[model samples]
Target: MAKLKDKRREKISVATEIDRLEERRSRCQDNLERAEFRSRKEKLTEKERQELEDEMAIMNERVQKLNKELDTLRGENRKNMLLSIALLAISAFFYYIFFYNEEDP
Candidate 1:
């Protein structure tokens, strides 16, 4: 029971973290898009343009990192599911061997 609760809590926490990361990534993407539009539509000093480019680069990196983290979390969830299935199969096998018996008439 405790283990189950722990797993549930951990799953919830991981899901929450993923949600937060996704939100952050979305915001960064929006910012990047706005910056791109601004760069295309307006004239700027060379220094300002360079700064905007740097900011866009940082945003891109952040988006990539978030995507990688999300993928890793998804993979971990898959691994956990597989492990749970394996455990259930093992438990069922043991139960069948130990508890399921036929009586002779």
Candidate 2:
């Protein structure tokens, strides 16, 4: 009976140690994430400051890839807008010169 009690106490001790380690790990993770967020926040430029709302969206989670995707989307949108405007202007000029000649020869 004494041996069984000792074994049970050993098991309880091990369980408590595991719980303590888990708590420490959770605290460490929280601190690390907070520090990372602080560091990233402190390094923004004025342009980036305007887009900090976007950074907050990704936060510390999946941020690198999300930021890359956001940048890519913004680039693509800008390129597409310039392409669209160029096409519109070229078409307007072509239409005017080909169909609306004011000189009668």
Instruction: Give me the candidate number with maximum lDDT.
Output: 1
Per-residue lDDT for 26 in model 1? Answer: 93
Clash pairs, candidate 1, are none
Clashes of 2: 0
Counting clashing residue pairs in each candidate, in order, gives 0, 0
Q: What does the lDDT read for residue 80 in candidate 1?
A: 81
List, residue by residue over 1-105, the lDDT tens digit for candidate 2. Answer: 999977875666433544554555456456557655765769867776656545544544444444454466556667877998999999999999998977888
List the candidate 1 regions with Cα displacement exceeding 4 Å: 1-12, 94-101
lDDT of 1: 0.87
Number of the predicted model whose TM-score against the real structure is largest: 1
